[model samples]
Target: MKKVLLYLKSYWKFALLAALLMGVEVTMDLLQPKLMEKIIDIGIAGMNLDFVLKTCLLMIGITIIGLFGGVGCSIFSTIAAQNIGADLRNDLFAKIQSFSFKNLDELNTGNLITVLTNDINTIQRIIMMGLAMMVRSPLLVIGSFIMAIITIPKLSWIIVLITPIIVAVLLTVNKRVYPLFYKVQQKLDQINTVIQENLAGIRVVKAFVRSNHEKERFRQSNEDYMLANITANQTMAVVMPLMILILNLAIVAVVWFGGIEINQGNLQAGSVIAFINYLMRLLQSLTMLGMVLIDISRATVSANRVENILKIEPTIKADHKQDDTFEIKGQIIFEDVSFSYDEDGEPTLSNLNFTIEAGETVGILGETGSGKSTLIQLIPRLYDVSSGRILIDGRDITEISPKTLRKQIGLVLQEAILFSGTIKENIGFGTGQISDQEMVEAAQIAQAEEFISSFKDSYDSPLSQRGVNLSGGQKQRLSIARTLALKTPILIFDDSTSAVDTKTESLILEALQQKRKDTTNIIIAQRISSIIEADKILVLEDGQITAIGTHQELLTTSKIYQDIYNSQFAKEEKNYA
Candidate 1:
């Protein structure tokens, strides 16, 4: 709540103006009934047509004023709500970007998506509704009560008695409904997760003919989401009818007692009529108050979720004290570094140490689950070292600003991800002002220029979402080209060429050698041919480096490397016959 309040503080001026306009609107509304009472009791009863005409015109003018005020309030509140929602979403996105990979591992992408879209929308609606109703409802309730007392003091007691009862009922409903709404939001996150997964992996689902299974899973999630929403709406549904019933009972009492007063000449017919109007207005405002409470409850829940994200301090923060610029020679050293996903789990890498000089190519080869990716990720500080230090040049990676450190390295993962954009845009993603010549050269180096040129639009051709229009090898080549376009000093290719044929792979390797002679490279691949020419190869087994040597040295010494080489390339070697 405090966090949300702080976020809203920036727009309080607009909120205040909206509140003031709503107050004026309610004041005009409350004044109308009083004027009607005046026309009826003092003008019509006294047979003064002039007084009635004058008062009716005054009422019309007040109504016009109220309408204008209402319109202004609506405009201001809508603007404020939209701005608040935008600011909140921007803050959430910034927070997500700042989080370390370890933090991201704990949050689902789908859940974050829901928070940025659905949850923020919910909170914005609540804020708009709150600003529109908060001041007006209370004014109507209290102003109507005061007018009633002035008109018929005896009848005002009914309002005093019934208002609290209505409030108590609303509070009770709110208490029960808030938790259900919170649960509903959680269930919504799950549904989003399932939908996102299915959309991303629809091809796999169809390939295995598991569409029915996926559908069933979606159905279960959808049903749970539906049930949660129904439960919350149903609980809130009770508040209105019960409020109406209580208001009706209060009306009956007012009429029953006022009739006696009229018979005894204690009250006029005009007062009775005006009192009933005020009673209805009061009841209507109380009902609006109930709705405001409902919105408030839901907003409270959403605000808490948003605040949870905002309050999470990123494990990775830029070192403000350190110089932003460093002469990076790309010398990477890991000194006795150890890491584990969880404290209770065995360490993925323990006491691992290695050093690579600038302008060197190092290959890491290992079976699945051997922490090959984790080992390379440390240099870029994707995940912090759990128990040791990683140095870039002579400076600890942690001591340097993350921006500076990452700007020095370019990474291409095994899974190539492309956003919906043109080929040129994807290649020049980070710094969007690359020259056409630079883009073409990078694509040529990745062996992607020929295919890109095959298209009629070439660089300007539109890419489908995630580059689904491109083949797997094309995507990998484009992803590599995108990395190369950055021209960073240290390049990390995590099985980047796995989808390309040997001929294309050889061309890319040749390009890398010819074009980036001074750059340091780290290659992680399953194919022995992929890393055969690396300056040095590190063999990993069970999260430990088993052999560190050239390929020929490993072939003579390491049985594991020999077997992998023999199985993958021995046939090709024989085919040379």
Candidate 2:
């Protein structure tokens, strides 16, 4: 609750104005019953028509004032709530962006999506309801109690006696419902996780003909979510009816006692009527207050979830002094580097020592799970080495800021991902501003220009989400083109050309050799042909570098490299035969 209140500090003025309006509205509401009492007792009782007419008009005017105040407060509260939600969401997104790869790995994409969208919405509603009702409901309850005492002192004991019971019941219900609401939210996150997985893997599910199995999984999650919500709401369902029952009983007691007083000529009819109105208003306010508590409980859980993410300190911090003024020479050296995904996990890479000189190309070959991808990931500090250091141009990678280090390297991953946008925008993603010639040249280098030109809109053609409209080879080519357009000094291609044909692959390699004279290239590939001409080749086996030398040197000296080469070329030799 305190954390949520702190978020509203930026909009204190709007909150204050809303409070003031609510106060005015409550004051006007309290005055209305009193004026009605005056019209009935002083004017009607004395048969004074002018006084009754005037009091009625005054009551109407006060009603209008109350209505205006109510609307004004609502508008202010809504605007304040929206602004707070927007600011909080923006801050959350920025914080997520700043987190290191390890941080993101700890938080799954689906859970983060839930926090950003659903949880934020819950907090917004709570803010709006809390601000709007916090002042008015309490004021109505307390004001009506005081007004009731003054109007009919004998009957005021009934309110004093019954109000405590009602409060106790509400508190009990809140205590039980609060934990259930938290559980409901957890179930909702699970449902979201299931939905997200299904959408992302829908093709795989269909390929395996497991749609029914997936549907059952989703149905189970949805059922759990429904059951949780139903349980929470069912518990809360006790509140309003019990409140109405207590209110009716209080009304019965008032009328029964007031009739006796009226027969004895001790209490007037107008005062009794006014007291009943005040009691009903008091009950209505109390109901709204109970509802507010329910919202606050749910919001409290949601705010805590959001705050947890916001409070996560990034593992990687940028150096304040590091700047991009110095140009990269594209030299990279890893000295006895070791790494693991987690503290408890076995090392993924061990004693990894290698060096690639400026303008040189190095090829990395390893079986799956041999840490080939993990090795390159360390170059940009995506995941820091658990031991040893990586250097670029004799400067430790850690000493350089991530922004500067990444700006010097262009990477193409095994899975080519594209956002929903035009081809031109996807190619020029983070370059700030790009010229048409540069975009075209990069596309041509990656052999993507031919297909791009075939499109009716050329570079302006809209891409579906994740470039779903493009073929696997086209997407891979575009991803390569996107990275190439950055023109960074260090290029890391992690099996990015696996989808391209042998002819196209040759063309891309030729282009890289011609255009990347000053760029250090790191190629991770399964095909020996992709790296046979490299300056150096390193063969990894079970997280250890078993062989490191030129392709011909390894082929002659290393049995593992020799076997891999023979196995691949043997197939080609048979095809020629």
Candidate 3:
């Protein structure tokens, strides 16, 4: 909580102004009971109607003054709290963006989403409410206690006695509620994970006719979340009634003692009335303090969650200080490169040694779990190799700034991800200051131009989220176009054309062969036909490269290659029949 509150340093002036205004409001509140006592004892008791009217006017004016103070405090507190929230959220997002792929894998997407939105919102709310109530409540309690002592010294003991009891209850509640609220946030993360997975794979669920299963899964998650919330609230619910009971009992004791003093003629009626008023104010402040404890407990948990993300140092760091004069010719060399997702786990890619000359079109072939995707992902430095080195153009990739290296390589993953935007914007997504001709040319190269032209709005046609409105094949083409638009010196296609038909896929490969002949292209494909024309092919099995050769050369020499080609060839012949 202390670390998170450091964001408030930038907005201290606004916060200070809010505290000062609260002081002014509290002063006005403290003066009210004293003024009422003066009116009743001097003006009303002496039958001075003129004095009574004047005192009433003064009280009204004081209330107006206090109203301005209260309103100003609220406005300034909001400004400070909102700015703090904005800064904290922006920093948190920036930190997440810096995280390495390994960090992301461990953190998970759903939990990060919850931390960004729900958890930060909790911190923001508590800050806004705390600024107003925390200051006002404490001041009211102390100020009212002092006024009560001044009004009747004999009854001051009641306040001193009641305060310790209220403090004890608040302390106990804080200890119990913190753990419950932490559990509540964990359950919320679970609910969010279920929703995210269900929504993202909604089509798959429907295709498999598992809608009832998804509903049951969601129902179970929602019930756990609800039960967690109920338990926390049930614990918190004990506070208000317990506080009210203490307040009512204290008030009764005051009234009882005051009446006895009145009969003995030791205390005036006006003084007794003022003392009772001050006592209520003092007790009510304690009640508000109890409420503030709940906010503090919940915010503490949120603060810790937010801080956890902020404190994590990204596993991968790029050397921004590296010289900018070096140029990449796209020649890649993997020297004894090996990687494992876990330190003690089996290697995904093991002792891999290979090289691709600049502008060479290379094919990577592997069966399921052969680490095809993992091999290419290492080139972009998405996940650093656990051992050995990967060099691009004779420079270790780690020595180059990630921003500089990634900009020169265009990578399209197996899954085609598109945002909700116009077709033009999707193609020209990150390549800044691109012209219309460039967008058209890239789309043409990816064979997406024909389908794009069919739309009524053409390039201006809007796409749904993840391009769900487009066919699977169309989405793949657009994903290719988006990467092609970068015109990077190196290109990686991780089975990005699997959804497209053979005709379209062949056209896209032919276009790349013709137009992007000068760029290095690494294509990972399941179908042998997809990479049959490549300059060289790599056959991988169990994290080891089994063979490396051209298409006809591999068919003659490599049995694994032969098995794949024969199986795919047989399937093609059967389809042709």
Q: Which candidate number has the best lDDT? A: 2
**What does candidate 3's lDDT look like per residue over 163-183, in tens digits?**
899889888987888788888
Whole-model lDDT per candidate: 0.89, 0.91, 0.90
Tell me the tens digit of each residue's lDDT in model 1 across 82-104: 99999999999999989998899
Error of 3 at 72 (Å): 0.6
Give me the overall lDDT of model 2.
Answer: 0.91
Judged by whole-model lDDT over C-alpha atoms, candidate 1 comes out at 0.89
User: 519-555, model 2: which lDDT tens digit per residue?
Assistant: 8999999999999899999999988999999988997
Assess candidate 3 and give its lDDT.
Answer: 0.90
Clashing pairs in 2: none
Clashes per candidate (backbone, < 3 Å): 0, 0, 0
Candidate 3 regions with alpha-carbon error over 4 angstroms: none
Q: What is the lDDT of residue 203 in candidate 2?
A: 89
Lowest-lDDT window of 10 residues in candidate 1? 319-328
